[model samples]
Target chain A: MSKAWTFGENMNTDEIIPGRYNITIDPLELAKNVFCEVKPEYVKNAQPGDVIVGGQNFGCGSSREHAPIAIKGSLAKCVIAASFARIFFRNAVNIGLPILECPEAAVGISEGDDVEVNLSTGEIINRTNGRRYQANPLPDFVLKIADAGGIVNFLKMHDIQEVLA
Target chain B: MGTLIEEIFSRRAGGTVQAGEIVLLDVDYIMSHDNTTPLAIKAFREIGKPILDKNKIVLHLDHAYPAPNILAAENHRKILDFVKEQQLPHLFQQGVCHQVMLEEGFVTPGSIIIGADSHSNTYGAMGAFGTGLGSTEIGVAWVTGKCWFKVPETIRVELSGHTQPGVYAKDVMIHIAGLLGMDGGTYRSVEFGGEYIDNLPMHERIIFPNMSTEIGAKCGLIAADDVTIAYLENETPAKGPFERIVPANPRYERVLEIDVSLLAPQVACHPDVDNVKPLMAVEGLEVHEVYIGTCTNARYEDLEIVANILKGRKVNPLTRVIVTPASARIYKKALKNGLIEILIDAGCIVTGAGCGACIGRHGGILAPGERALTTMNRNFVGRMGSPLSEIYLASPATAAATALTGRITDPRGCL
Candidate 1:
């Protein structure tokens, strides 16, 4: 249960992880720079478990996974937007970031509001407003990937080790 | 109990995918622009592995031609350094990756391709599941042949009727995006078809897939056809496997139609490709910049449209316009056609043929609180340089018109 960190709708990847750092490869390095290019001071003042709620077309622009990795690396638990870009959404999941599509939820969740997300039930509860949004639940297979810390690691974790006799 | 959609799902689907689900993916293509190469080169060494496939890799220089910024010039040097060292197959000394890939041949339909730059989905026009990626994921994908993907559901867009005098494919896309809202198509595929789409010029139909990502679709496409064959043979030649793949009319779960005959002038409001309205509705909004570049609409024909508009008149002093061709070849052709001179004589700045404003790598960025009407794609916040800047998406005609008036003006009146 954490207070939600809110932003206006349509918060893009460039706003979430600006282009000045598109060159960097380290996820941790990206985390430090997340929103810094756009907001300049987002990471310095941001707390862990904050949620970025946005409006339509959130995470639009280069299908870069860094957009999500940077946000997740910064320790933000989830990003709830009215909608998510296809590539951005895919990249976020591929990197083990949480993105919730709560079209109506953003209308109610203001900045500095508190919200808790239940991974199992796909529920996001707003503490200040006593509001609840039922987010679209994730696919079972994708959950395994995220649970195992993204796809690359998830593949490593689920190694069945073929025993050829 | 399941149908074709569920079948495409079963092939890659596992676990639960829902609105709140943030799942990991396997990458197919990893692409990079001029700036990211130096760092990507450094990280590749840290990964400590030989490139898995050089042929699959693409290294392009789309930003800063004649060199825009010092950093871009330095980046160009780094890209040349690494591309030569690795013996990469897909290196573009002149064109943007989007045009070069479709021309020189790197994107294979059905393969998932990622780039270090945004708008890599330009390849989706050729039917590849291409998109942008970060330097890290790109570096890793270079080492390992495997990438991740979670099957995304598809949204079908059907187009009907024929084009009116001035409407083009870009307008059609912008018009739809405006209606659907930016996020409406988020996380879906736009499968295009209908009477008009079926007969569109292969090069023209490309505008659909190229700008699909702007409206949030992963890849916008019309199933490959005879027209595609004609274009591929003309653009990319060699004995390769390419078959005409058409989507079954009834198999498409959702269908949308656009009667080109009935459409009018359109514009994507500042900062959002989907914030669209009739161009007439937003008329009179002043513009200080008009950019006629980027992978989405910087095609050769796109240049011709601009040249035609500015042939006889000078641009408005208050408005600064830049036109970057998609490739060196297009540059030469425009020069041959005398379109380049028309642009320059009219005070339109012409840069090298790489992606300029479209990639935000260089050229045509707005100052804080500045406004622009452009023919490029993706007008998100801080996209062009200043976070407070505003951008409106439109056709080359509209862009040229605005360039003449120094604000959002209808192209129909100027000519």
Candidate 2:
């Protein structure tokens, strides 16, 4: 079971990880400062496999992949948002951070609510309320990349030329 | 017929690609700056591959250049080593990546360029299909010389009427951002058109695309026309057989018509780029600092506007003013034109050319409870310094006027 940490719409990358700390790219190091400005206690209280639930355009602003990297490093299982900015979605995929688009789950989930998710089946269960929601399942190619622990590992197994062709 | 993005992607994909289809396309240029290049280098090493084509990769040591801290210095050293090891020929240490990219002639119409920074959309001003990506994707592009893209649905914004004096492109863009909330253009392409855009010079046209990201746009574009061709032929080093690509019969998901005939000078308030209000609403608000620089407005013409306002006036004693030109070339041009002298004479601290203070890595940073008025884009929390500090976004004219008054003053009154 994972606890949901809810946030409002248009939660930007600068809120996730401030630009001042972008000099270091280490995921763990970046994790320490995740939500440091917006939610000062997030890094301290967040547990492994916790979930982040947000309204529209989550992870908006800037192309800093550090935002997703920090969230992944924080041991958050996945981020469920009503929508995501274009660059953030791609960055999450590149880093193997699971994300789902489910307006129902994003709006229904409450802070500290225990939840369960199934990436392959797109099933999201709110254990606290006994509600089940369906998220838009990721594409097959994206699922393949996530399964291999991101594109780098996927590329290690497949030929780049073949993939491009 | 397809939209502008569809046309660009179809040509790159060598097929009839639609908005929703994901396709792998060859990228012409891949750019990374100091803030991201270090991370991309690490990812590239993890891939254990040689750079597929070193010439296609561009590196800039602009963000936090000269190293604000030990970690940043170390990151710069790592990037320098990687550039040398790869024998990369396009490494630049002098200017913001976006400005240098255009000045060096890497941006051409109908070309696809991806950078590891959000404002890569600035290249779209010249009619290129440019967008930002993460470091890992940039690293992968370095290895394969290609990247996948989900062709975005286009939003057509048509601007009409004449822009009044003191109403610049920055004001027009801020007004647009207010009309459309932060997510108005999420994951979509925004194409600016109509008489207003048609009349803007290349420098002014660049702001729309550069600020499109503020509204969550994947890219902001304007079709290449004679003005674009003229700029490329005369201004840039591009010896391009440039292609003028306009949609023959374009389809748009939504169309918005905006009239800027009497648009007022606008400001995007603290903690949100979309919380825009006219200068009358926020006028006389005291500011601790005023910054005039960024990819959005630090071009030569923008400096001239500020210099005209500050030519014989002194900056208010209570406020600190910092001016950073977008590029070294722009800095030289401003110096040659005596704009730097006017700015310096008015008591503004002229800093080196780069993404100075805009990213809060170096240069002027606001303290807690302080407020700043800047010409840069993005006023998200903690963007320019303390999270408790406030940032107001406006044009260089507004910045100059506010700097002179130590408060948010209307540029028209000063003019």
Candidate 3:
């Protein structure tokens, strides 16, 4: 089980990692500052396999993949949101950071609640409350990419031309 | 039968596909800037492949150009070294990546372009299927020249009626943001059509798509028409031949009809782009700085609007006004037309053409507790500097007018 970190609606990329720190592309360095402003203790307190739960339109601003990179670098297992912005969703998938769209899990999961998720089955269980929820499973191709550990790994296994064809 | 995005995707997919279908298609151009290129380069190295087509890749050093710190300098050096190593032909240090892409003729109608920046949707103004991707995706595209996309359902925004004298495209977009909320067009393609969009100049038309990200849209497109062609001919003579695209029987998931005939100047208040209100609601709120630039509204025409508002007038002594042209080309044009002089004479600090101040990497960062009024998009918390500072989004006219009063004043009142 993992701890849940909850955030309100429209949590933007800037809030995830301020643009000032964008000078560095190092994920670990970026991770140290993740949620520094909004949740000052996030980087220090968030443990491996912690799940971030957010309200609607989570990750709504800038296309900085650094946001997801920061979250993943922090060793968070996955992000669960009521809904996600398009680019953020793509960024997370491209980087192999698991994310789910389950409104019930987003609202029902309380901060510091013990949570468990199954990316393949789209199942989220709030161990604290004994409630389970279902998320829309990712498409097969996207799951394939995620399973391979991101688009780069997926590309290594399959020829680009063949993939397009 | 299909929306504009569906048509573009069909051509690339080589088959008729609907909104929910996924297709892998070859991309025409891939762009990345200082903020994203280093990460993309790292991913590209991890992929262990040579660039598939050096000609199709474009890079810029705009986000924190002229290196504000040692890390930025190192990143710039890395991008430069990679560009040299790959013999890439499209490295541009001249301006913001998006504006430079258009000025350099990379964005063509009915083409598919992806960038490592969200505002890549800005290319949709020319009727291209432009969307943003992560640096890793850009790295993958560098090796493969192709990416996958799920054709998005269409949100048809039919804009009618004429904007009032001081009302501008920025206001129209802010109004749309107000109506749609932040995620109104999430995972969808928003196509702006009808009389209002048809009548906007090229510079103005670009604002719609540029700010589309504010509404969580995948892309915001305008069908290629005579206005688009005319702008292309005038601005990008070397651009390749392209066909104008318009959906014959486009299907839409939802339709929003907005009449701008009597619209007032609008502002997106602090911390949220969707938290919009008419100028009257936030009038007289003091601002410490007034910024007029960004891909959203920093075109030469937008500068001209600021010039017209500031001509023979002076900015409030207490307010600091910073104006950045979107590109060096725009800076030169403004210089040639004496807009630069007008801005300077009005006490505005004119910065180099780049993404300066907008991303808060360097120029004009706000101090703690300070408030700013800018013509840029995205007023999210800490967007400009201190987390406690505030950013209010408005038009160039409103920015200039506010610069004169050091407060949020309606441009119409000044006019």
Each candidate structure's TM-score, on Cα atoms with residue i matched to residue i, is 0.84, 0.98, 0.98
Q: What lDDT does candidate 3 reach at residue B183? A: 90
Where does candidate 3 stray beyond 4 Å? A161-165
Tell how far residue A101 is off in model 2, in angstroms.
1.2
True contacts kept of 1: 0.36
Candidate 2 CAPRI-style tier: medium
Clashes per candidate (backbone, < 3 Å): 42, 0, 1
DockQ winner, 1 or 3: 3
- Model 2: CA > 4 A from native: A161-165
Pairs with steric clashes in candidate 2: none
* CA error at residue A33 for candidate 2, angstroms: 0.7
Error of 2 at B215 (Å): 0.9
Candidate 1 vs candidate 3, TM-score winner: 3
Would you give me the overall lDDT of model 2? Answer: 0.91
Candidate 3, residues B276-343, lDDT tens digits: the string is 99999999999999998888989999999999999999999999899989999999999999999999
Residue pairs whose backbone atoms clash in candidate 3: B1-B249
> Cα deviation of A103 in candidate 2 (Å)?
0.9
Write candidate 1's Cα lDDT for A1-165 as tens digits.
565666666677788776656655567898887877556566777788777777766777665666787888888888888777666765676667877877888778887788888766779898888888898776666576567665456434353111000
